[model samples]
Target: MIILSVESSCDETSVAITKDGKEVLSNIVLSQIDIHKVFGGVVPEVASRQHVEHMTQVFSEAILKANITIEEIDFVAVTQGPGLIGALLVGINAAVAFAYSHDKPIMGVNHLFGHIYASQIENEMKFPAVALLVSGGHTELLYIKDHYQIEQLGSTLDDAVGEAYDKVARSLGLPYPGGPVVDKLAHTGKDTYKLPRPYLNKEEFNFSFSGLKSAVINLVHNAEQRNEKIDVANMCASFQESVTDVLVDKTKRCAAKYNVKQIIVAGGVAANKGLREKLAEQIKDIEIIIPSIKYCTDQAAMIGIAAYYQNKIEPAKKDYFIKGDSTLDINQS
Candidate 1:
């Protein structure tokens, strides 16, 4: 199936064309990272405006890059929810127009499912797997029984991991999107601060990063108050260590408990070097699948991949392609 997909969940305005959900022909993403950097984070109104400005251009580019006409696209797939409502509507409205004009079927895909199914682009997914989804707005552990069956194992009680990373980065006077910067600096320094690994003592799959973020903020604030120098690199390293340790430990335990065939680490934070390396070193038995960095973040390709599978299980109807749902549940499908 040739799937044309739209994704304007947050600061990214993306469109993609995929063949059979496994091969991505073109995935065009226009990110507003630089624009939002000045504000320290994404501004909803700004993101919505940017999406409106670029949605048509992105769609045209995606089609051109794919070397396919709109008629060749079997169906249209778009991110339905779990994102900024205004940003999502831009993509959803565009998709609706495109679908209606082309007389093609459209489907609203869950953003979280897109993250998990993104692994299909690089590797074939195995059933009965556990997925660790860590991103800016969400942190969740999910049990995947098959392509059509996924259950939420646990999720963040407070701020998501990526949120914690960004908050910690701001406290340290780092850039807006802090995950990559923090991850990079972490490699240059040692884990000297010895930050706490929140909820590591608990056996549940739940996570909590609010406390960890606060600890880092407090440490930085205290050092500044005393006029003491703060080792930014070391602090990044320590913070990354604390976060990765708990995530890896809980994920491993969840996989073992379920006796899953493989583990899929999805979401934006899956691009973190620390989490990738630790998961590789620690989990020796089961296979671990992490998509390439491009697929790890928000993109239309993953949404297309997810929509392909959904179409296989149940074909989409025009009525199903309605307005966006900001809080669409992962297990809704």
Candidate 2:
């Protein structure tokens, strides 16, 4: 099946053409990092406007690169929610228009589900798997027993890991979209700052990054007050180590508790080299799957893969209406 998917849940305007959900014929993503970098974070109105400006061009490029005409597309898939409503609407409306014109089936996919399925693009997902989804807007742990059967194992009570990373980077005078920047700096220094690992001993699977974030802020402020030269790289390395330690430990405990056959890390933060290395070193008994860097971030190919499964499990009706839902929950969807 040829699936054309659109994803504009956030700052990226993306489109992809996939064959049988596994093979991506063409995946095109136009990032707004250059635009948002000036503001130090995403501006919803700006993101929405940019999507409107770039959606058409991005879609066309994906189709052209796929070397397939609109007539060859079997279905249209799009991210419908759990993102900025305005940004989400851009993709949904475009997809709705295409499906309406082509008279083809259209599936509304949950954005988080897209993140989880991203690993499937390169590795076949095993049943009874545990997924650790870490992103700018969300931090969640999920248990998957089948294609449609998913349970929320845990989630962050305050700021998501990516949010914490950005905030910490800003405090250290790092650039916007701080996760990758921090990860790169982390490798150059040692973890000498001794940052606290929040909720490390908690029995529940929930996460709490707020305390850790505050700790970093206080450490930075204290050093500045004392006029002491701080080691920015070492601080970054220390912060990353604390976060990675908690994430890996919790995920390992969950995998053992649930007796899952495999573990998959998904979402944008899953691209962190620190987290990937930690998982590789810690989770030795079970299968571990992490999507390639390209698929780890927001993209349409993952949405297409998710829609393929959604279509098989619950086909959309002819009159089904697509809408943007910023708070759409994956477990309920």
Candidate 3:
């Protein structure tokens, strides 16, 4: 089946075409990072407007690159919730229009589910796996028995890991979208400063990054008051180490508790070199499945993959249209 998918969950306006849910024919993503960088973060209104401006161009590019006509598409899929309402609406409306005009089935997919299924592209996934989902707006650990069965193991009580990263970066005078920058800086520095690892000793799968974020901010503020030369790279390294320790330890403990043999790391933070290396170094005996960096972030290809799996359990209605749901849960269809 050929699936045409759209994802405007945040700052990206993306469109993708997939075949049989495993092969991505075309994945076009127009990012507004440059536009949002000046403000040090994404402005919801600005992001939504950009999505509206580029949705058509992105859709057209995806179709052209896929070398397929609208009639050839088997169904339409779009991220309907768990994201910025305005951004989600843009993709949802585009998808609704395509499905209605073409008389095709339409499936509304959860944005988080899109991240989870991203690992399925160009690869086979084993069931009964534990997935650590970390992104800008969400941090969750999920238990996946199959495509149709998923349970939330735990989630963040405050800021998501990606959000914390951006906040910490801002505190350190780094640019917006700080996860990658911090990760890169961390590689060259030493963990001289000892940052607290939040909830590392807790037995639960839940996460709390707010404390860590505050600790970094306070540390920076205190050093500035003392007129001490701040070691930016060292602070980055230390901060990353603390976050990585907590995440990897919690994930490992969760896998052991659930007795799952497979572990999948999904979402934007899965692209972190520090996190990936830590997981590889710490987690032994279980198979770890992580997508390439491209798939780790928000994209429509993942939405297409997720829609295929969603369709297998519950088929989409030909005449049904969906609206954007900003708070869509992972367990909800």
Candidate 4:
């Protein structure tokens, strides 16, 4: 089956074509990183504008480069919600229009499910796996009994790991999308500040990064008041150490509780070099399934894979799609 998918859930606009779920014919992503850099974070309006400008070409190039014609597409897939409203609407509307013109089946896919199903591009998926979803907007642990089943084990009570990274990096005057920069600097400096690992010993898998973020802010504020020069590298290192510690501990606990044979680390933070290394070293004996860096974040190929499974069900035909609540359930993920 030829499935064409579009993703504009956030700043990046991506389009992809997948055959039979596993083979990726073409995956094109136009990143708006440079556009949002000076602003320190994504501006919803700017993201929406870029999506509108690029969505058309992104879809066209993806299909053309895949050596396929629109007539050959069997399904049209798109991310429906739990993202910036404007950004989500861009993809939903585009998919609807395309499906209508082509008379193809249209499927609305959950953003989180796209992340989990990204693994299909690499290898066959086995059920009963744990999903560690870490991203700019969300941090969640999920139990997957099968392709259509997902139970959120626990999630953040406050800020997500990536959000914390951005806030902490801003404290150190670093760039936006701070997780990666912090991870890189972490290697050069020692964990000198001993940053707090919020909810580290909590009985449940739920996390709380807001406290950690506040801690970093307080430390930086006090240092500025005292006219003390801060070691940015050490600060980054200290912060990442705390973040990774929490993720590792919670992941291990979930694995033990569920007794799963595999763990799939999904979402943008799944591309974190530090997090990947930590999981690889700690998750012994069980297979660790992570999409390649390209598929780790937002992309349509993953969306198509999830839609393929949902295609078994009749899709709801609609010209307009609703933007989902931020707290939308991951069971659909």
The candidate that wins on lDDT is 1
Better by lDDT, candidate 4 or 2: 2
Please provide, for model 4 over 266-317, each residue's C-alpha lDDT reduced to its tens digit, 9 standing for 90 to 100. Answer: 8988888878888889888888888889888788888888878766654534
- List TM-scores for all candidates, in order: 0.98, 0.97, 0.97, 0.95
C-alpha lDDT score of every prediction, in listed order? 0.93, 0.92, 0.91, 0.86
Ranking by lDDT: 1, 2, 3, 4
> Candidate 2 versus the native: TM-score?
0.97
Our tally of clashes for model 3 stands at: 0
Q: How far is each candidate from the true structure, as Cα RMSD in Å? A: 1.2, 1.3, 1.3, 1.9
Q: For candidate 2, which ten residues in a row score worst on lDDT?
A: 317-326
Error of 1 at 72 (Å): 1.0
lDDT tens per residue, model 1, 1-333:
899999999999999999997999999999999999999999999999999999999999999999998889999999988899999889999999999988899988999999999999999999999999999999999999999699999999899999999999999999989999999999999999999989745779999999999999999999999999999999999999999999999999999999999999999999999999999999999999999999999999999999999998878777745644526577786
Cα TM-score of candidate 3: 0.97
Worst window of 10 by summed lDDT in candidate 1: 319-328
Q: 54-129 in candidate 2: lDDT tens per residue?
A: 9999999999999999999988988988899999888989999878888988888899999999999999999999
Off by over 4 Å in 3: 323-326
What C-alpha root-mean-square deviation, in Å, does candidate 4 show against the real structure?
Answer: 1.9
